[model samples]
Target: MVSGLLWPIIKKTGPLLMLLGLAAGGYWLNRHYREILTPDIALGERLYQQGVDGGGHALQGVTQNDIAFDDAQFNCAQCHRRSGFGSSEGGNYVLPVTGTILFKPRTFERADLFNKLFKESQGQVFRARMRSAYQRPAYSDESLARAIREGVDPSGRQLSPLMPRYRLNDTDMAALIAYLHQLSIRNDPGVDEQTVYLATVVGPNVDSADKTAMLATMREFVEWLNLETQGNLDHPNFSPGYRSDFAKAFRLWRHEVWELPADPRQWPTELASRYRRQPVFAFIGGMVNGDWTPIHDFCEASRIPCLFPFTDLPPTGHTNRYSMYFNQGLILEAKAMGRFLRAQKDPETRTVVNIHSGEPRSSQPAKTLTQSLHGDKRYLVVDLTFESIEQLRDQWQKLARQQSAPIQAVIWPGTFDKTIAAELPLLARYAERLLLPSPALEANQTRFPADIAGKLYFSYPYELPTAYHPHAFRVRAWMNTRDLAIENQRLQFNTYYALNLLQFGLEHVVDHFSRDYLLEYIENEAENQLNPGTFPRLSLGPGQRFASKGAYIVQLVNNDQRQIHPVGDWIIP
Candidate 1:
């Protein structure tokens, strides 16, 4: 009787248990298979950043805020950066969307809230501003969607007036949430437990003295940095200003020298091969007299950070993330000269002659100037290979006679020699309007003659020497103590400045070692705050490849003194 009564109950409950088990198994399989198909995090990131859908379609969103944005101007990453860290715009701060912030409990002071949301908080654990903005509980997926769609917080409080209410479907919204869950969680290469590897690149045509000087400064800087951070590297102690998690992020600097081949074409291949063997976190300072385009391309392709190269002819117009230059180098000089030539008092005399030795490095400025003219034939290029004083004089004379009209101006993009001093006084008789780069002339200062002091106008790219002294005094003293010969003042100062800037930037970066973040930090913050080195004022911004944007047209003053006074305003060409 007991068995018969229990049998019915067992049969009924057994089927129910089996059904529940099968349902749970089916759900797990569906989830596992869905992950294989949709890579939710990556898909969401693509949709958020690129405004693209899973099927390679351009995803769109509509916003009904200040201005109705029915178009793709509603990209999530545009306002809330790729890291899901929101930004301040037009007096309003956008809320962060990262899962770490969105799904966590809140107990943070208002003062520390801003830092936490931006990932800039150091040694302070704080809740995100978004989470602290209301008295509501943690956000559920449903509430998050409602917040995004209705421009309201989880606490039923309205968002800022500038906040755009986005319209996203369930699938897209889920993907974005998944992406936010994993944002900024992956570890980047080029850094290890004990070392942060860097590479310094050099071109085939770099001057031996300059190459030596650059390498020496770089090596010494690395040594000094390692020594200063020795305790941190070994025992892992976070400084007062740094985040505790970044205690072990400090590492010994290990650098490698990469020398590119004489053939520009081989640089990409060589850099690729070298990188394959030993990848680097960043490139410090590079020197190249010839084309840097190949190296620039390599850096962009390989996604390596390249800081201020000693090259004038940097590739332009294309967008870049990895490379930053001191200035257009010689190209800025040419543009300044071009503007000077265009502003000449004599409009009738349109023909300006550019005299350069046939060397590739010297010819670059003229090419840049000619290109800047943009089909305006007022400027003329003349390649005169002068081996001796007689040859230079002969070429100068020939050019003087060859001009159909009074020459508007003459530009010598190459270095000045002792021979040029004698020729300049004579040449001044024919061409009173002469343009010479101050850098080229400064090297041969002793050789410069008294007679032609006031005659030639120089394209001065830096601040006056006296002005540079104040900013460069400490650096100069340091170099002197090290007994490093000041063979090239600009090169030494630039190298020193680059290293210092990199160090300061790395301090701010802490454990975030993204190459893009490093570049962004340098471009946005370091460029503005750092003391001016050889440059009068150095600055870089989003999409700006060059640091120094303007040049001065100044005339030399005092007989044989090399003193100069501004001829015109600082011109940005």
Candidate 2:
């Protein structure tokens, strides 16, 4: 037929459209199948294997007595083993004083480590270790290089006296680091002085047999306060008693210390609510309302410098968005818990119950008495201890008898002791008891929203943990929601929305460093575990060059020792 020219145009255009459609289909498929690794994810895997905390590697499964250590012999049983504890098969005994350690954890950025080793300290925190290591002539630069290359300590000291140096051939170090170029970093958890112990600090490092006031402060913080020295970030102006007086904590460097009046922030107890909107001062405030007086009273009065000084993330959008410093937000968790439970809830009956009974929440995001629970949906909050078994059974019978849509959900969020959690009957009726856990949850006792001792009651520079909770703080202000959610039996602070208290401490930092190195080592661990004939090369999985799935704390549980094993903390089995 006398065909129209349309066939040519249609033929050309049809192919182009087909190509476009294929491209769209490919993009959708990639999005669906993409597997990204994240920092939080690595945290979920088990590495400690019953040997240590999430932040460290330790002999957890074995009792302290089981790991033989005689102090007079200065034995470190964990690594050196018990053949007289590093006495050695080679017939050479490693001397503790003859060697010192240079811990280059992966978290130790070379620049940062160089500064820490060479600069950064005007104080004496590291005097003993640094001085002792430096004094050894064998520890000269070449020796360090050889030790790293040959697995020896600087004093020609065999590693039993120290961490056995890795035999990183130059080619291996270069290629391995090249492989690690894509490794991701996120925030780290808190740590403290309790990590090293006072003896480790005072041992061979400090030549000063005489103690100074600074040493006294260090001693007290370690022994009593359970404080971890976080270097200089926390200067003199700090929390509690010293928050008001700068001179008490810090020697004023720039100017004369701003001597603040003691009574300046004392709140009038009756008019507490009036001062609620106003800061009596940053550090100072009395028990005006339910919230204890602001801990930053002294620093507030003097306007001492603080961390993260602004309210919102930068307008440039956290451009200074990157922070190596750990804030409570980075550490503490315990939001978004309701959603997880809400999703996994029983649908037929519409009852919501809360079961917390211990320390109540000091701040709440649950809004108000009316808002804590949905109005139309049925609500029933009960405590295991609230009623005798007979009464509770009767109540459960009633709940079970409710109309089809009578109760929506029962939110049982807090941690009851095993005795209670095991005994609670109604929880068995639910799909699953939601536990949004972090390493902190296991360690955080009744005293903390996170770790046991790491509360705002500690830490000088950081403000109250309650104040920093963005979701809770912003929402709670309107409703005077203080103490409401904490009272509600169904909710709790956990990894979902709760922050860990010790994230910023020194032990946390070292633990983080240890973990970071462990991660690099873990690819090796995994390879060894699988013993894959082919070496596993690093690749950004699926579609991208980076993933956030690499962060989780792995616990090794043998004989019920659930210790979090960071990668570098020890030799993995």
Candidate 3:
């Protein structure tokens, strides 16, 4: 009788167990579905930042305070590490939030929070569940937030016993959001304001009587600057439209000093005293035409860099406060030429003829052509000599006649003696030439008609600031640079790359005018902070960067037409 009674009790207990199991199962399914669909704002941020701008953490710059969340951890960097904040309770290395799991919420976004909750797998990552919580859905975002700060949920549901709400104040919440918003920033150090100032080199060029007065005025300006802005090189907190009356007067004075006649005495001393209180700054540079060593030495002693031809100068290691913004030696010119030639390929013309100037390797001159030349190949070796260029052309013509080769083109370097052209008849039609590579020739870029100059290319001795595209190069012509021939597709490709290197450096190293304006600008960096378009204009090529070492190559159409190009242009072996 006892056994029979036990069986009935066992049967009743089995039904109760089934009812409990089904309830538990239903709750889990709802929770899982919620987590998968509405993921979070952080997911979107991760995708946008990591993929765009070529990879890095995404920052919405949204701080915990922006959304009015109260937690010292709103920076999202502090808590669950990398900010997803979910830890598994059970499966593999699991410990879950012990409290209430509210549905997920998309944190830190202007969009409807619901849309940002789910994380969509990119590529195969979507298909495989892996360790990702994306499929299972994250912890109920609201429940989690409540659990962290308050021990209870919106429904007064007690959450993981481990968490207790520590009420936070309003001030702390605002600060948190502010910090997050601040964090989501792009760290691009673009060129600061295009500052302008006068640099004068006082010499015999100045009047003796005016010199003492000028010196006194300049020192005063220095004193004024020292007192004004605290010498910060970065942007000072000045509003956009403030009138720089004092600075304008100085800039106007700059034009006077820069364009000063051979004799400073020709100008009135009073005007000079009023604006020329700044230091005497010299334009130091190098080119083949003059002795540039002293200027080079002065600039080097000052650590100023220049994009000069491939010459090596040492650090100042000196007492001179001056510096040079450098232009590397002739190598920059050569590399620029290579980029120009590589861009100009047509199927019919596979051969490249680089006629550079160098000492003859043998007792007699021989053509040194790039061995890489192949297909549609052709080359011409025109040796340089004092004899009229006609003599050299006469010889080339004779050879051309014997070989029946259609002497396609001619490229000449400035390093050659132009008088040699009196002999060669083929180079007279230089304007019709297709390719000229050199900083100097390119300086006169726009003048060369792009229509006639097929596949023409050139490099700025110094490129523009952050010149990511060719539009900057097209604008360079307006900066008084020689207009370049954008002969169809070739120019569209090469000018931008060449421009990126040169222009960026020029703009970067020469941000300031001379040291005195710098000192004053520093003192008034806040007061005198110029916009990106401000003076010292950073203009290149309009004036021969006579101070910077630069060179160029020009092409001459192989014709008997009557105008010759610059000397020492390239010829093949």
Q: Pick by lDDT: which candidate is best?
A: 1
lDDT of each: 0.70, 0.27, 0.32
Clashing pairs in 1: none
Least accurate stretch of 10 residues (summed lDDT) in model 2? 281-290
Residue 258 miss distance in model 2 (angstroms): 21
Better of 1 and 2 by lDDT: 1
Highest TM-score model number: 1
**Positional deviation of 158 in candidate 1, in angstroms?**
5.4
Candidate 2: lDDT of 103?
22
**Tens digits of lDDT, candidate 2, 1-573:** 525887788777998999999999999878766532122222212111122223433322221233432121221222222111111112233321111232221121222132234422434534444334333343443454565345465556543323333333343333323222222232122112223211101111211322222233222223322322333226433553433332222111111111222342543332233233332211110111112113233223332211121111111112121111112221122122233223334554444433332322211212222233344343443322223335545555565465344432222222222223223334345412322223223323332212211111110112222233334443233223332222211012211111111122222123223222222222112212221111111122111211111222122222133333321211101
182 in model 2: Cα distance from truth in Å? 48
Clashes of each: 0, 70, 92
- Candidate scoring better on lDDT of 1 and 3: 1
Off by over 4 Å in 1: 1-65, 70-78, 82-148, 152-162, 168-183, 233-246, 356-363, 371-399, 402-404, 412-429, 443-446, 468-471, 480-485, 558-561
**Native-vs-model 1 lDDT?**
0.70
